[model samples]
Target: MEPIQHKIYHVDSFHSRTFLDTYCAKKPEMDLGEECLRLTMEELHYFFKFANIKGGTLIDISIGPIIFHLYSACECFKEIILLRFNDHCIIELKKWLHDRTGAFDWTHALSFVAEKEGISELSEEKDMRLKAAIKHVVKCYDDRENITDPLVLPPADCVLVTNVLDVISKDKVDFIRNLQKFTKLLKPGGQFLLYGALNATYYIVGKDKFHLFNYNENFIRKAIEQEGFVINHCQVRPRKTESDLTDFKAIIFVSAYKN
Candidate 1:
């Protein structure tokens, strides 16, 4: 058998529209969205509201063109900066932010977040707030020592990363290196929230398979602790949707603070 690297495609070759339709669209059947989007949104909403993680700038580094998780975040932070790994993802994000025609409809996700907040009728308002909160959407280079090279960013009050490290990292050491790079974006005592899959080796998007760094909750906890982050809350939910598109055993949500 060949190495895992030879079997999986890089995330840079990902098709944004296909990825969104495959996992984020609201379909009648049980899909990856149930665990990846809805559960993540629910956890983020609860964490932002009760964890005392509010104010200042919030930086978001995520996989694909996902904005569902940011609905609740706009309420807590004054500004949001989105960092993307490639131009395709950046374009997809801008389409939604600018209300372009072919943008993915996020109404379902917005409605779910609104319902959670007890303002089911105010979903549109919530969407508008999220749009207003986003201050910048910039491309970042993972190969560079500074992901945002030539464009230094101020330390943010909060940093949120969702399903990104696992998809991009080549190995455990690469994962830790990327984690530290993201951590450097946070201010002292700043809050950090990470949402990812557990024991996931691969996920499919538009007939293409992308690699995921297989890891467990214990590894995640140890990594964050080693990076000087105090884990405040950590929860793992068993995989609810059984699909060949992804083979993740569980989903993990972690809330921590820079110590």
Candidate 2:
């Protein structure tokens, strides 16, 4: 088998329903939902902790069809833009956002976040807030011309990139370059939130596989700092999923500010 490379980022064959069912299923029977729950909790807690982030623009640079990452953006930002590399993820996002047919239901993830926030029946409320907050879902890519081009995009106060940098980058240098692209999307001193697997080289979506840059906590910190970001918070949780799902050893979260 040949090694997966950066080009896998352009493969727009994401199986939205299959991917969600395989990873986001509530496995109370085997307690397999712990990792998903933990990530949702940590993401929500961090978003709430920075209470000052209310009512601003947020840009979500996503690589997959998963909407769980955007759950907290609804509460923090007045306008949310879901940016992707191709039609696959954007199509799924729009389907959910527009209440169209065959949308991958994000009910379980929203409910999990609601339960963590001590709201038993407010998941629907959260769902509505997210739907309302998301004003646009766009297709975008990270290239020299794309990133270096003048910013025609509305200024964002916060930019969220989750599990995307490594997948799109070929190596550490590429990762840093891509990080610059993300930072450019932000205003001066804007907030930035990132989540990704630590020391991972590959991840799977259904039966198709993709590559990841082998990044460590130290590398992430240095890369962000190089782009003039002040780290506010960082956390890493040991991976708790079955090996077949992913080979990553831990999940890393970082909240920072452009400086």
Candidate 3:
């Protein structure tokens, strides 16, 4: 018998709807959802309130079309510029933003965020607020010298990245290189919030298994520090559920500021 071979992300076909259905769907009993959706929202809510990182522009470079993490962020940042490597993700995001039919339902995630904030606002209102905060969704190429080439983006006050580097980076060097590219988008003294899985080698989207750069907390801390960013708050949550879909040991969130 032969071992199963996984397909590489970016190199292989990735279905946006499949990815959302598998991971971002409203599943209360699933630990994957609890950790990625709920825990991430909770951390961001607290981080924004405590750190007070309000600003004019924020650059978001995250995996897929997941927007749950931004529920709390819309309140803090006036404008959000979303950068994407894939066209499918951009289309899916636009569908939700424009209130098009067949968009992925994120009301459950919104409800959780509202509860955390102790707010009585309906999910529709919160969704509208988030949609308004997002200013643009632009396609990006990682291979280019300037990731956001042609349309030069203004230096942002903050940048938020979630689980993107791990999927795209082939090695530590690639990871650091991509990190540098993202950091260049930030203004001096800008905040960089990163959320990633620790000790993860792969994750499943649909039937395809995509590569993940296996890294731990120390490696991430060192990588960020090497870029001259001052670490502010770092949190790691151990994986609470048993699943064969992914092999990540924990999830990590780090808040840092460029010096």
List TM-scores for all candidates, in order: 0.95, 0.88, 0.96
Determine which window of 10 residues in candidate 1 has minimal summed lDDT: 1-10
For every model shown, the clashing-pair count is 0, 0, 0
Candidate 2 vs. true structure, TM-score = 0.88
Regions of model 1 farther than 4 Å from truth: 6-12
Q: After superposition, how far is residue 233 of candidate 3 from its true place, in Å?
A: 0.8
lDDT of 3 by residue, 1-259 (tens): 2232566566678888888887788865554788778889999999998888989999999999888999899999999999988889999999999989999999889889889889877657888988999999999888977798988999999999999988888888889999999999999999999999999988988777888888999999999999999998999999997877799999999999988
Off by over 4 Å in 2: 1-7, 27-32, 147-151
lDDT of 2 by residue, 1-259 (tens): 3355533655546665665566666556433356654575556566665647754899888666667867766777788887777666677778888889887766777776776667857546788888898887777767754552443677799888877887788777778888887888888878888888888877676677767788789999999887888998888888776756567888888889976
Candidates in order have lDDT scores of: 0.87, 0.74, 0.89
Model 1 per-residue lDDT tens digits across residues 65-154? 899999999999999999988678899999999999999999999889888989847546788899999999988877778889989999
The Cα RMSD in angstroms, rounded to one decimal, for candidate 3 relative to the true structure is 2.5
